[model samples]
Structures are given as structure tokens and as C-alpha cells.
Target chain A: MLVIEDLQVELAGKTLLKDIDLEIRPGETHILFGPNGSGKTSLLMTIMGYPQYIVKKGKITFKGVDITHAPINERAALGIGMSYQRPPTINGLKTRQMVDICAKTKVDTEGMARSLNFGDFLDRDVNAGFSGGEIKRSELLQLKAQDPDLMLFDEPESGVDIENMALIGTTIAQILQKNPPRAEKGKPFVQQQKERTKMGLIITHTGYILDYVPADKGQVLYGGVIACAGNPREIFQCIGQMGYEECVKCTI
Target chain B: MYDLEDLKEKARQALDKKASFGGDLDLNTFDRSFVPHKYLAEEEICAIPQEEQKRLIMSGLDVTGHGRGGTYFQKDTSVIHCQSKEEGIQVIPVTEALKNHDWVKDYFWKLVPVDQDKYTASALLELHDGYVIRALPGSKSVYPIQACLYLDKENLQQNVHNLIIAEEGSELHIITGCATSPHVKRGVHVGISEFFVKKGAKLSFTMIHNWAEEMDVRPRSVARVEEGGIFINNYICMKPVRSIQMYPTTYLVGDNATAMFYSIIVGTPGSYLDIGGRIYLKNRGSRAEIIQRSISNGAHIINRGHLIGEAPEIKAHLECKGLLLKGGIIDSIPQLEGHVEGVDMSHEAAVGKVAQEEINYLMSRGLSEDQATSTIVRGFLSIDIKGLPEALKAEIDRAIDTSNKDSM
Candidate 1:
């Protein structure tokens, strides 16, 4: 399980988020919705332990360990991984080598890349000249190799074209264990849920991903705080009908 | 072809003339007398001391001669071992070739001027033994020929002049390693090399330098390419040297000729390197490219590149990139000259430390900070040469890997 309590975050001496409380147990996937500059990415970055995101008064726990002050690599080693929206390009490092680094062991990088339609780019430098959709596939391919317990996706569908949307969405579902195996198709719902241990927190702007991946809950972040929480589909419908300002007003 | 007496007079006049760059060295402070060693057979090369063999291997000289087409081993001032195992190739000492072969007279000092600087003049006045490697026409080498210039005499100035030629319709590859004995601390080396690429031929020469910390090295080299010919030059110097300076030049004299120069350098503390490459695209449809990578670790390094396009429809480019680590000075100079309106030329030069964002990105993939930095540094030193053989590429990678371990 992953938990955050009273998470107050500051960046570059300016407060970006405050009084944030969130939790996601095993087999649970949550969706985060917010307006521009509403501390959505900041909340995710703070949880990932980026040194730039200073925790003024908060604590983050992952798998029963307090990790509010842990370094980024330590958190990564402890089954925490994130897919960045605009990761920097590392020259001279082949994507094939990067997959091995993420795995920390020998892996079938070529097989994994073929599944993501990224086999051709495995020999190129990491993100040296990748297009928008290609970058997304590269990031997801690394996360697949990592196989972390806690996965974070920041705007997975922002720059994706319509053709790649389904591929990206389905891959995310498979990574989070939202899709049950063929043998478990006839099992009872309770038994299947008990077997799912992967956890996910996805930040989406268009809500297009909800059509492919099921979300257990959704929350609205306004003024650096979670203003409302409800069913994922209902929250999307309400936000679509009325602007974020109206929703925040009614919840407050 | 020319008068030897007149050439001697020119060399005497410029014996004391200072070079255009780098720190000056007093020529009178070192010994110029010849140091002789017994001839070594093919098997005897492996019998050399283990420590000395290790240093030679690091510079890409295979003492066992397993995959080499030929071997030329020069110790101090004499050719201790010179032979060609492959058919269509000839490896002989420069002094012997000039003394016996009539064809050698036409090539000796043909491309490189003898009075360019004090070092070139010194090579002409007190010329020691060097190699003359040539490829027969319409023939190809099965493996690269290996050459080693080993300095074992202390405080001795070794003057050498080398000539290489690739005849028409032939392909040749050469690997030369220059190293010093483990016990020899202080010395000077002056080398003059001239290269000729005949029509429709291809030639690639790779040189690796592994010198002692107190050694001063000056090498003068020039190349000329005929019509439909190709020339590839690679240079790598990773170990420490007190001071070294060289700027090799290549001329595309015939139509559709091509030349490419790639260099990788690492500067350690108390080391000063002034190295660069210059190419002249003189004919129509000629092309030239010069790419250099340099890293300074508390040393002073000056990286220079120049591309000159003298005819219409010619193309040229120059690139120089440097990384400053552990408080050192890196001066990168890239120049492009287009003498005609229809010529195309460009240049890009950058010098800075590794970007932090690149490091942080790697860290997020579960690598520690130290691992991330070294990965970036290794990548920074790796360059993809278009036409290099797989064996040579592997050799370059091994050199970079060893240097990365020491630098980090």
C-alpha cells in the first residue's frame, strides 16, 4: 500500500501543494483530475521523491516504510516507478541498454520492444529524436521491464494520436494487472481481486483512458487540496458538464 | 627527385624555429644518438617482458600477431621486427627502402614539408628508422597491419619519418601504436608521416598513443587523395603526456575524392595537448569531414579543426566537442572556409560539462549517481565511424573502456 498524509510541498521556495491526503491499497487504481497549475504534477513529483519538491510538513509511506526523505533511486529500488511526460534525452545510451538497466538483469529487450512496436528504435540513443507517440512507447517499455509494484503515469495520452491511443491504453491496463488472465476469466470477482497486487496512480487530462482501463476512484485537486472524491465515471461526467470552478464551489 | 644537399640546408635553417602553438621544448636537452636492439622474429615478439607487452596491448598492438596482416616493431631508433605475412602488402624500414628501392625516392617527403617547424626539421636532420607500408594495385588486405613505435631509451629524442601508399583499386587498413617503456620517464618523439591514396583506392589509418607522463611528442602528417579515392584517419590518445602537438592535413586533389578525420583525446593532470585536423576540398564533387571529442581532467587541451572548400560543388564540415572535468582548460576552435560560391561548408563546436538533467534521467531508471555519471562520460567518448572495420571498432571500444575506468 502507498499512503500520503498532510502532504505540504514547496518548489524553489514557493508553496505548490498543501494539506494533501491520499492512499491507494493493493489492487486499486486511482485517477487524478485538476485544472492547469492545480498541483497535479507537483503532487505526483512529491510522492516520487524528486529533490526539488521540498516536503515542508508531510510524510510518505510505501509498503509500510516511511519514505518522505528517501532519495529518488532508493524509492525506485523499493518498487516505485514513474513514466515521465517529457523526459530528457540521454545521448550515446541505446534504448536497448536502457531497458537492461531498468531490469537490473538480463532481459529479452528485443522481445519486449517488438511488443511495443519499438524494435526499430532499440538501437538508437535514448529518446534522441523520438516523436510524441514513440516517446510514450519508450517510457512504457522501460516501465514494463522494471515491473515495479507501484506505477505512476503522468499524462500517458496527452500527445498520443488516435491510432496509438488504444495500444497505449491496453498496455497500461496489462501493466497494472487490470486485465485478468485467461484462466481467471471464469473465477469469482472476489477471488480475482484478491490475486491482483499491482497499484497505479494515473493523471489524465482528457479522460480518454477511462474507456479502456477501469479506475476504482477519482479525486479533484483544487487550490492545492483534494476538494471532492467519488466514483470515477460520475466525477468525469460532472466535470464535463460544469467547469472545475463550479465543481469546487459545490464541494467546498 | 630533389637535391639532398638543398633539403639538408633547409632543415638546418629551421632547426631552431619555434612551432606555431603549444609549449616550446629545447631540442638540445635530449640525446639523439641511436639505440639498437636485436631483431625479433614473429615468435620472439611474444617473449618480451609481460609488463611491456601489457602497455603495448593497451595501445592496440597485438604481440601474438593473431589477426594482423603484417607487423612492424621499432625499438627506440631501429626496426627490430618488420615483416608482411599477407600477400599483396609490403612492410619495410624507411631507411632500407630509401637505400634500395627506386620507387621510395618519389614519395619521401613528397606531401609533408620538411621545414614546417622545429620538430619537422629535427625529423629531417636526425632521421631515425620508421616503416614504409604499401598495398599492391588491385589487391585488398585480409587483416589490418599492426605497427608499434616503442621508446625504451631514457631522455632520448627519437626522430622518425614514415610513408604509406595505397595503390589504385586497392584497400588497406593500418593500426599504429606509439608507447614508452614503463621505466623510461622523460623523452621526446618527433614523427613525420606522409600518406598517398591512389585513384580508386581506399585507405584507413588508426593511431593510438600511450606515452609516459614526462614525454613530449610532435607528429607531422599529411595525405593526398586521387580521383575516386577515400581516406579515413582515426587518432586516440588517452594516457598522460607532458606536452604533445600535431595538426594533420589532408588534400582532396582529384574529383569526387573524400576524406574523414575522427579524433578522441583525454588530458590528465600535467598534460598539455594541442591537436587538430585540417582538410582541403580542392576539386569539384569532393567532400571532407573532421570530428573531434576531447575530455580534460586538470589538464590544458586545445582542440582545433579546419575545413576549406576551394572549388564549386565541394562540401565540408567540422565539429569539435569537449568536456571539462576536475578543473581543466579546454579550448575548442572550429573553422570553415568556402572559397567558391557553390561550395557548402559548416561547423559546430561545444565545450561543457555533462548535463545534470541527463544524469537525473538515468537515475530514475534505478542507477546510482556514480553509475549515471560514468555512463554519460562513456557515451560522450564513443563516436560512430562510418566505414571502420568491426575488429577496429572493438579495439576502439576497449581503449575507451579502459580510459573511462581510469578517468572516473
Candidate 2:
């Protein structure tokens, strides 16, 4: 579980996010709604400890440990994973190669494909020239390999085509359902569930994200504050109608 | 006690003082009759004309003493010596190997002519390529053969011809070099080398050249690759020289032949280094690759690599990248041309400074800003050392490591 208490972020000499508060727990998905440059992506990147997003104030505690300034790899080691909106393409590095790297295991490549629906192009360079849908699947595959304690999704629905949305949504559910529980050395059944790896913060912008991902709570972040909280469908309909700009105006 | 310039002056004077060490002092047969392009595509259908076979004789001499408007002469091999029993494992002067052993002299340069031009042949005859090395079948020498040449005098014209032959299934590593050591006047240093590879043979040639201040060093070399041969050429230019224009060519004449060339040119304040490799797929089903990376700071480095697929069923790839910093300049020109359709050829080039995003990503992984940048730079260079010989891999890594440390 991770908790963000009034997080304030500033970058490139500009105050981006001002006093934002949120929390994510195991087995729960939280969709953060905001428009471009409204600090939506910055908040996700900030939680993942991107060095460029300088946290000017507030505190971020992961599993009761204050980690507002932890290094990226350190955070990674602590099971904090993120799916970038525009993932970086690792040239000359193949997709399966990255899977092997992050998995740190000889993952069942065939099974992984069946799960993510990308069995045809595992040998190609990592995201070198992937389609929109393919890129989204790669992110999901990386998350499965990493199995982070806290998962942050930034616009996962951007590339999900209508034909594959249901499959992708189901694949994610399967991953969450088939969780190996928290890994504990030399422990069986009960220890496995204790390993209960977590997936928490789920951010989406287009107002159409949770049509696939059933989240614990859907909150609106407008003008750098929690503008509203309600059912996923209700919030989707509001943003679907007025957009985040009107949401901010209504917050006033 | 010998500064690079001082050494160059001495080498020039020693040559003028007369060839003290007698190695190969005969045969300056020149080929006045140029082999026209018509003759080029026309292989020896029947023992190439007597005139053509006569031109193929393994000798370093051209008539009238000049080759292709360039000066030509044999080298003085006295600089070479057996430091210990290890260097003598299978090492022999190229010319000596040719005269005493008929098979070596007859078959070595038979493919690649030292006298591809008039002066080269003339120079081959004069002093001969100074030294000849014969790594017998299955002979793996531990110590590198050191071929040192000095540009002794200023304004003096010198042409040094050399030959190396790696016999069947043999492994020979050569650390051939030339520098403007102290005593050598500010002048020109032109050194040429030609090598032959027999079946199943492997050779690692490391060439490191540091020219004296204000001196122009020009080196030209060629290697003839045979069936199942592996030739690795790693060239490093650490210091700035006036004008360095070199194009080392590898002819893959047999099937299943593999050749890889990795070169790094570090040009400093005021230097111009134009270096690259040419791989000519002369036979079917051959494979070759050339990777050239140059790092320049306040200098100019030009890397031009070309893969010429002369025959079908060949695979050739060329990748060139230039990393420039501190107002330095770099020009990368990579070309892959296939005459035949069955060949797979691709050439790409990228010119850049260290990517900021890559640096940041690496830094976020517990590396300092400097550490991150160097790691990315090293990754850019750690490309070809994967399948190289252990010694070569180590040397390449060391060079890159040193460069990384220095940049930091």
C-alpha cells in the first residue's frame, strides 16, 4: 500500500502540481482524471520518482516508509511499477530480451503471448516500431514481469483498439487474478498469498479508461486538487460530457 | 628518452645512412602495363596471361621507383627482434619466410599484390616490406609481433612495405604500428602492409598510431581473406595527427568467410582523421560487417565505411556513429551497395552527442551524471567486442574504459 499526503511537484521552473492527496491499496485500482498539462502525467511520473519532477513539498509514503526522494531503481526494487503513456523504445533491444531482463527468469514466452495477445512479434526490437495496441501490451507484459507492489497506469486505454480492448482488459484481470501472492522464500500456500503483490494507482485521461479496468474508486483531479469522487460510470459520463475544463470550473 | 618527433627524425636519418640491417634487398620488378577494368572482371580463365602471372609475383618493387604518383621503397626490418622465445613461437620475417619457404612466398601475396600499383611493386623489391611473419599451421603465438617504423628525417619521402601470412588453422596476432618518434623531422610517413589468410586461419590485427606533432602520417593496408577465415582489425587513434587518410580493405574470396572491423578515432583540438574499412564480398554466401565510431572534441573526425557486394548470396551490414562534444565536428558517410540481388546489405549512420534522456535514465539508476553518461557511451562502443578474441576484447574494453574515465 502507498499513500500520497498533499504532494506538491515543480519542474522546469514551473509549479506543476499543487497540494494533491491520494492513496492506493492492494487489489484496488484508482483512476486519476485530469487534462493535458493539468499535471496528470507529472503526478504519475512524480510518484515513480522521476528525478526531473522535483517535489517541492509534501510526503509520499510507500508501505509506511517515506520515499518521497527515493531513486528510481530503489523504488523499482521496492515493487513500484509504472506504464508510461509514451513508452521509450529501446533500440537494438528485443522485446523478449526485455521480458527476460525484467522477469530475470526464462519466462514462458508462449504463455506470455497468449496472456498479452502479442505472440507473433516477441523477437523484434523492443517497441522499435510497434503499433499503438502493441505498445500497450508491452507495458502490461513488463508490469507482469516486474510484479510491483504499487502500479501506476498513465493512459493505458490510449492505444487499446476496439477489437482488442476486451482481450486486453481480460488479460489484465487474469494477471491480477492469477497473482502468485507475495514471494517468500521456502514458504508454501499461505506464504504465497502473503506475497500478495499489489496494483494500486490507475490514472487515465480520456474519460474512457475504466470501461475495461474495474477500479476501487474513480476520483477527479481538477486545478491540482481532488475535484470529485463517485462511481466510475458516473464520473466517466460527467467528463464524457463536460471534460476536465468544465470540471475545474464547476469545482470553483 | 625518445620523443615521438625525435624518433621520426632518427628513422628518416637511419634510412638515408643506408640499410644497415639486410633483410630483403632485391627484386624491384614493376608492372608498367596497367590491368584494365576489362582485365579485372576477367579472372584467370586459363592461368592469366604470362604477363599477368608475371605481375603476380610476390615482390614489393615498381619500375622507376614511384607507384601511382606515390613514392615506393622496401622497409628496413632491423627494428624487429625476438624479445624472447615466446615472440619466436612461430614468428618469421615476411620476406625471410617467402625466400626460405616456397609455399609461403608463392601463395601469400598471390591473391593481394603489394604492387597493385607501380610504386608498391617497386618498393616491395627495394627493401621488401621490411618484415614478413609466418604463423605456421595451428601455431598460436602468445606475444604480439611488433612491427615498428620510424619517420626519421623531415621532408624525406619513405615507403615501407610489409607482408604477413597466417597459415591454415593458425592464429597470429599482430600489433603493427608507426609513430613520429623524436629525432624524426616534421615530414610525411607512408607505411603500407598486405596480409594473406589461409583456410581456417584467424588473425587479430591491432593498429595504434600516434603521429608526432606537426607530422603527417599516412598508412594504407590490405588483407586477403580465404575460406573459413576470421580477420579482426581494431584500430585506435588516440592523439591528434595532421592528416590521417586510411582505408583498409578486406576481400572475402571464399564462402562462409567472416570479417569484422571496429575502429575508434579520438581526435583532439586540431586533428583530421579520415578512417574506415571496405569489405568486398568477392564470393558467394560471404558475410562481413564494419562498425566505426568516432569521438571528437574541438577536432574533426570523418568515418566513411562501405560494403561492396561483388557477388550474390552475401550479407553485409555497416553501422557508423559519431559522437561530438566541446565544439568538435564529426562526419559519418556509410555506404552499402550490392551489385548482385541475392545479397542482404544495410548501412545506417547516427550523428549525435550523448542523449540527455538516456543520461537521466542511467543517473536515476544510482549513477552520477558523469557515470550515467559514460555508461551510455561505453554501451555505444561495446558493440563488436562480443565475439572477438579474448585479448582483443580486453584491449578494446580497456581503451573504452580509459576513454570513459578520462571524459568523466
**If scored against the real structure, what TM-score would every candidate get?**
0.97, 0.61
Q: Against the true structure, whose DockQ is highest?
A: 1
Query: How far is A243's C-alpha from truth in model 2 (Å)?
Result: 11
Candidate 1, DockQ score (0 to 1)? 0.77
Global Cα RMSD, each model: 1.6, 13.7
Residue pairs in steric clash, candidate 1? none
Worst ten in a row by lDDT for model 1 chain B: B1-10
Candidate 1 lDDT over residue span B153-239, tens digit each: 999999999999999989999999999999999999999999999999999999999999999999999999999899999999989
For candidate 2, the docking band is: incorrect
| DockQ, candidate 2, vs. native dimer | 0.12
TM-score leader: 1
